[model samples]
Target: MNLATHAALLGWIPVVLLLFASLPPRRALVAALVGGWLFLPVAGYDVTGYHDKHMVLSAGMLAGAVAFAPGRLAAFRPRLVDLPMTIWCAWPFVSSLANGLGAYEGGAAVLFNTARWGVPWLLGRTLLADRGGVRALAVGVLTGALVYVPLCLWEIRMSPQLHAALYGFHQHAFDQTVRWGGTFRPMVFMHHGLMVALWMAVGSILAVALWTRRTLRDVGGIGMPWIAVALVGTTVLTKSTGAVVLLAVGASVLLLADGARVRALLIVLALAAPAYMAVRLTGEAPRTAVLDAAARVASPVRLASLRFRLANEEQLAAKALERPITGWGRYGRWIAYDDQGRAATPDGFWVIALGQFGLVGLAAITAATVLPVVRLAVRLRRRRAAAPGAGPAVALGVVLALFAVDSLFNAMTNPVYFVAGGALAGVDVRSLVRRRRPAAAQGRAPAPVVVAGAALASPAGSAR
Candidate 1:
């Protein structure tokens, strides 16, 4: 994934897109922002030891700084959701220091680590700060992945040469691109073909969510139904069972419940993934029955992989327990070893988080992501009232939960996840503000507040 500086400087293409995106009817900016994230080369130009798409993030951070500068202070105001996120961001420094690595080295590592989640989270909070913004973010993701569909089709035929052709190096192992039936899987510009499948899964779910709410026209056009099907087609082509499973899960939730309930379900799911990991790590869960069920449903190959991951996670969890509080910290410290002292990388992101940051760090990150959906779901259910951004919030929350669980299987380092999370954070905070408005503010009676504005709540005070 390393793009040489000359090739990496080309990363500015999407940041440059912001110029035209600013001319938007809003979708324009979303397209630019998301296009920048999805299309940009990953691991472009290292800062310290961690190399990722630094230029892409710089584009977002640059935009946020300018947008919130000077007279625009209120737009930058913090909400209850920010508290855990703030902790999430700051705790890395604590963990880094605890690593007992040289202070300077630990500090440097922490800076780039912050970029992994912090920067994109900030982009959503600032750039797309409203329901329109949230919708735009979702559509932007759809379109961004849509843009990849053609590229994916190309790779399916030609194999994944796009990154090497464009950036002068392939992003992943050549053998991994060769799939079950000997067909080539599309990697596009992502770290792995699985990552491509994951993004397509997110896009498919997002498109269907938009179509259900009829906001597809706002972002894509009347042809969005077809577009959704096409995205689903791409997901199937990915040959990654996880993508297919998530698509069914997302669509079923959308069909059965309103956005609030969907979000509440997401809260439960968010908690459950880690909880299972906790149980599995302790060997306290019914391992035999779980594997038997997975064997019954999953192909033998897939079930074997799952069992292997569970076994590895158990080993890593035991090692992590030795330094339960602050965790093993950077380098190869978080990795586990056998009696022969051979090291193994923990396969799950949650496992890695547990081994590296311990429970404190894990809880902080999990809460940072989950609480926004929880807050929105509660607000949506309690007053039995529509909430601002609930439609987009629900869709985004679904992606959030799907991705969170997927992270247990995959690292979930895709910047778009953070962008969605930050947008949900903004949506949650904004809904809270609108709900808590003073009677004086609500008493003014502003245009009936548009009752059917697709989950934008009317002021309770406006009621008879």
Candidate 2:
């Protein structure tokens, strides 16, 4: 919206180029995706179309990938796992055409949607489809969150003014930033305080998981244990109860659960969004029970907020059912209006997808995001030993599942999850877990034990 915002948004193109030119393709992708998502202005320009920073970043990455990592792209063979994302990208165009918007509109929608969702997944699949690449991504996220620590703390102490101070506008309502008896819930560069909270919480979970697995000990010279503590403390300071709860659940699973239990939990989390949608559409949302449970723990204001969201979801569900198949197209066609003709807004992404693209679209998007985790879960279930060296991938799968769970209540979309999903989609469950033959059986000395990036001492007490 402002000069600085425009400059930062447009300027990221060259930054993407520089990253690719200077770093490895996978690392470049990670840096470009994470850095742009974190610091770029939320607004975008409408040169030919409404090209936001997300599209711009994806475009730059695509170009960089084409020039630098063409082999990855050339060798890409579409599999059953890719169908959901392909459909997710293609369905918008179909929905547009179904609503009589014609091919031009449909084609354009396809391009934008693919860039928003597909390109990131493709990049992850091509560039980060291995064990080292997966760890790099996990580290990239942890590093990005660590980078946000000071900015978040500053915003928490001083109010969420960095966006306004730097970009010449506040990204969201100022009142939303005030929480916990006037303490600040920092938004930093994200669209909402909750997003920042979720980011921090996820980082905290990864820090702990990686540290415990010994996959990572230090990020940029700081010890992982201290990094975990800082991230955990900052996540709590963000004042989002939901994100904190998710962090707790993820950490608990990683710490306490065995392979089977973790796999089961991942499946549940993966199914949560779809199940909620189905329940809402069938008018069996259990609103009263949910509200009663919320009432026990939530303040009156928070309780009212939940009640309002549920009520709006019911109204929106009714409206979405009018079209049923493809639902309404873009603009405000999918939105319900009251007697005063004011449009009702959707708070959750699942409802928004249902309204805009109907069941087919919703399922496509859900599968695109959630299916990879399900597949990874299945693999882990079958091969329990893979769970050790697969810490980063498992952490990513957990985050993806949590992203699905969060989509039920909030609508924040980060392409990094797609990156993680794509990685999981292509990763071999046994990639990181190396099998060593017994010394007696092989008539030779045993090899060193390495799991999750850390090497265990061999029989002679020497680390590899």
State the lDDT of candidate 1 residue by residue for 1-464, as single tens digits: 34453554554544445443444323434544565556566555444423566445545444544543323324577887877767766666677778776667556656655666776677677666675567556656766767778888889888999888877788789898988776798998788888899889888887777667654442222266777888899999988988789888887887676645665676676676767767776677765767888888899889988888777777888888887777877677889888898776576787788788777777777777776666656556533323433555677878887777787877756777776777777764444325355446756642221111111112231111
Number of backbone collisions per candidate, in order? Answer: 0, 0
Q: Give all candidates' CA lDDT scores.
A: 0.66, 0.81
Model 2 lDDT per residue over 1-464, tens place = 77898788777778778878876787788778888888887778785333776777788788889988899999999999999999888888889989999998888878877888899899999999887678778877887888899899999999999989999999899998888776899988888999999999999988887888777657545787898999999998898888998999889988887767888888887888778778877867578978998999898988999999988887888899898888787777899987898777698998888898888888889998889988888877535523446778888988888888898889988888888888888887777565545557768673432222333223221223
**Model 1: runs farther than 4 Å from truth?**
1-21, 24-29, 48-50, 58-60, 67-75, 218-222, 258-263, 382-389, 428-464
lDDT, model 2: 0.81
